[model samples]
Target: MRSFLYVPGNQPKMLASALTRGADALIADLEDAVPPGEKETARHTVATWLRSLPAGAPVWVRVNSGPDGLADARA
Candidate 1:
């Protein structure tokens, strides 16, 4: 079985170190873990982190619901 770890999207340090941990996959979360005021910032941070990946990294994103979710999807 594979393991997946959850990391808050707003956390840059966690995002940078997550892939080194040994989990088979990662779930970068932008929902309940992030305060509303930081939502936009988290989106950008997550997006930038995703781009910085070396490719084929097993990372999944947990976006929020409603309009915010749509924005997350777009990011």
Candidate 2:
């Protein structure tokens, strides 16, 4: 986990390729990298991405902190 990479959650191609991007950890960004209006779509994409990750993958989510973030956490 010495190195980390941040990928915008809305990019399908980047998301698909994130697993082997060589970073020690991956952050599927749902905050600033994504536009406000696209948060819902990003959340769905990030949820799918998290579920698809292989066992032992080093990943961390950076959801905004608040009710909106709580909603993302719930997703």
Q: Report the lDDT tens digits of candidate 1 across residue range 1-75.
A: 389999999999999999999999999999999999999999999999999998899999999999999999999
Stretches of model 1 off by over 4 angstroms after superposition: none
User: What TM-score would candidate 2 get against the native?
Assistant: 0.91
lDDT of 2 by residue, 1-75 (tens): 588999998886898898888998888888788898898999999999888889988888888778879878888
lDDT of 1: 0.96
Give candidate 1's error at residue 56 in angstroms: 0.8
The superposed Cα distance between candidate 1 and the true structure at residue 60, in angstroms, equals 0.3
Give candidate 2 misplaced runs (Cα > 4 Å): none
Report lDDT per candidate. Answer: 0.96, 0.86
Residue 32, candidate 1: Cα error in Å is 1.1
Which numbered prediction scores highest in TM-score against the true structure?
1
Per-candidate count of clashing residue pairs (backbone under 3 Å): 0, 0
Residues forming the 10-long window of minimal summed lDDT in candidate 2 = 59-68
